[model samples]
Target chain A: MARLSLNQKTTDRWSVAEAVAGCVRAGLPSIGLWREPVQAIGVPTAARLVADAGLRVSSLCRGGFLTAADPARRRRALDDNRRAVDEAAELGAACLVMVVGGLPEGSRDLAGARERMAEGIAELAPYAAGRGVRLALEPMHPIFCADRGVLSTLGQALDLAERFPAEQVGVVVDTFHVWWDPDVLGQIRRARGRVASFQVCDWITPLPPDALLSRGMMGDGHIDFPLLRRAVEQAGYAGDIEVEIFNAEVWAADPDAVVATLARRYVTHVLPD
Target chain B: MARLSLNQKTTDRWSVAEAVAGCVRAGLPSIGLWREPVQAIGVPTAARLVADAGLRVSSLCRGGFLTAADPARRRRALDDNRRAVDEAAELGAACLVMVVGGLPEGSRDLAGARERMAEGIAELAPYAAGRGVRLALEPMHPIFCADRGVLSTLGQALDLAERFPAEQVGVVVDTFHVWWDPDVLGQIRRARGRVASFQVCDWITPLPPDALLSRGMMGDGHIDFPLLRRAVEQAGYAGDIEVEIFNAEVWAADPDAVVATLARRYVTHVLPD
Candidate 1:
């Protein structure tokens, strides 16, 4: 329970103040922040609210979309990520989770897209390190590889992360995104020092029409959460395990009830035996 | 065009006879068959029909759902796969493509499920080899890794295939599945003479409600088909290249028009330049 964090997206309707109040009310030790909600209240106000609540910020929602082929769009993406980094630093986030963009419009060259993503990271890692923030590269499920994250596997993320200092660039191990990987255990082991954030969510089938909201509550799906939890723990990721579900049903549920359900599941499904 | 094969599912409305005639009509050199339609018309009649039309059988649709945990269910799966191998031999298919089953009902033990799949392949490989039918394991995309295939990458399939003699077990390189793989080109290079079938289909986004029917026609999605075709060709596989799309729109279209569209896409997107 001490390691549990409520990712704000898990309770989509909650504002920063509402989420901070909700986390404190739920007896949660931490909360993961999204940039939009933080920016709405202004970063200083959001940071002060969490600090007053004595809640740690697990991670910033995202900071990468570096696959833009156009020079102006790519420049905007990098500038936006730099702003995201500033927000993470102000919020005292553990890291800024990176969802590297997929192929550009009208493009089929995956290798080229991935190369651009690497370059984006190389350009950002030093700046992030200077700000005392780590850029956490997330390897989304391959289902999202064409439009979301070009980094489709932890191994691929590591290939890029390994190029930078471990303090500057790391990786996120989101259960829903990586549970299907045959080599996940090995990759998690390899991620040792570079595992910036460990997120928990279940992979549900009959994935909604919008695949983006396909995650389910932990016990309701087929993932053996304890197995992955144990692996991440063994990898020395002594950090908050954020419950970050994106399902529409979850978003529609009463925010307090969603927090209660996830906290209980976190204990039953994710805590080490 | 000489190497192009129409996988029967690409024209779901066609009977075995109609599919064979359609191939001849479309000037396709080969046809990939599904066991259900082949069994529906009786394997002998279907085999004779295709042989009579002088259309080579590229590969049999499937065989390995061998991850059953129950003793009776496991035995039945092996027996069914054995029958599938017999059908492939009777149809003179170059190989029998295997989509290994996912976790058993109410199960979360992925490692155990994968081990069972390996054992199933081991048990069936000898019988398949004796029948002169190679078992071509198809590594589905990770999206299907939970419900459809435990084998989620060409490298994982090859790890299983390489344990058996090359003639006894080979692998299917379906572009739709492996195209998202960062290591696909390297795995294709590793496949070399063990590549049994090369399948092509584009991957479109906003995947239809049923993820199973999500594949798009080539040139409609983001896959670089010619790149994949060239990789398979360089791997020393001169086998029929099967176009195995499963889009609902494709299934509902006029079979001949669908064939014509695929033929054009094949030459434009898949053929060596």
Candidate 2:
């Protein structure tokens, strides 16, 4: 229970204040914050609200979209990421999760897009390190490779992360995005000492019309949560395990109820025996 | 142009008779046949239709889904696959594409599901070989790993295919599925003789509400068709290149127009210099 964090996205309708209150009421020790909610409430206010509720910010989601072809857009993205690092620092987040952007518009060069992402991370890693924020590269599902994140496997993310210092850059093991990788267990082992965060959600099939919201509540889908948790724990990631489902149905539920459901599932499916 | 094969699903609305006629009208030398359509028109009749038109059946559009948990259901799947093999042999298809099933219902055991798929394939491979049909494992994009095919990369497919004789087991290199893989080029090289088929289809973003229909016409999406075609050719595959798109908009268009569009795109985006 101590390591269970309810990512705000599991109950996306909840305001920052509401999320903090819900976490405390649900007896959760931490919460994963999204930038939009924190920004809406003012970063300081949001940070204070969570602290006052005795909740730690497990992670800040997110700080990357580094694959824009236009030079101006790419520069703006880098500038924005630096600001995100500052916010993550202010919020005392364990890491700044990155959903690196996909291919530049009208570009068929996947390799080129990946190169740009590496350059973006190289430029931002030092800035993030200076702020005591880790850049957590999240390898989203391959479905999102073209439009959301070119980094589509834990191995790919780790390859990029390994280029930077362990304290400065790391990888996010999000179940929904990577549960299908046959090499995930090996990748988790390889990611030892550099796993920035471990997120739990389930893979539900017949993905909703909008694939992004296809993430399911832990027990509602077919992921072997315990297996992933054990692998991450074995990899030395003894940090918060965030429940970050992006399902429309879950989001429509009451925030408190959502938190309660997440806690129950976390105990049943994710916690180490 | 001689190697271009119109996969029936690209104009899904077209019946077997219509598809055969359409291919002949477009001066296409081959067509990729789906089991449902062939079964509808009767396999022998459908085979005769293609043969009479001097059109080759580039490949049969499937025969696997071998990941059922129920013993009875699993047996049924194998039986169906045997029938698919007979049809492929009857049609003189270069290979029978396999879209292996995802995890069984009420199961979160991906590894186990994959094992079952392997067992099923091992059993079917001999039967396929006996019938003079090659079993072509098509690794659908990982997004479909949970519900469609556990074989999600060409490397994974080749790993399984390598376990059997090349004539008994092979792999389908579909651009839409394997384009995102960083190791795709290397995998294609490894596939060489076991490269049963080379499929072409562009990957469009903002995937339609239904992700399955998100495949775009060549040149309409982000895939560099020539790059992939070159890799496949370099791998020593000199067989027909099948255009297998699953798009609602494309299907809604007239079949002749769709074939014309596919041919135009094939020349502009897929054909080598």
Per lDDT, the best of the predicted structures is: 1
Encode model 1's per-residue lDDT on A1-273: one tens digit a residue.
888899999999999999999999999999999999999999999999999999999999989999998999999999999999999999999999999998899899999999999999999999999999999999999999899989999999999999998989999999999999999999999999999999999977766777888899998888999889889889988999999999899999999999999999988888847
lDDT of 2: 0.91
Which pairs of residues collide in model 1? none
lDDT by residue for model 2 (B151-249), tens? 988888988999999999999999999999988899999999989999999888678888778889888888888888888888899999999989889
lDDT of 1 by residue, B27-121 (tens): 99999999999889899999999999999999998898888899999999999999998999998999999999888888999999999999999
Task: State which candidate has the highest TM-score.
Answer: 1
Write down the TM-score for model 1.
0.99
Worst 10 residues of 2 chain A by lDDT: A264-273
lDDT value, candidate 1, whole model = 0.93
Give me the displacement of residue B112 in model 2, in angstroms: 0.7
lDDT of 2 at A146: 87
Interface RMSD of each: 0.9, 1.0
How well does candidate 2 score on lDDT at residue A126?
Answer: 93
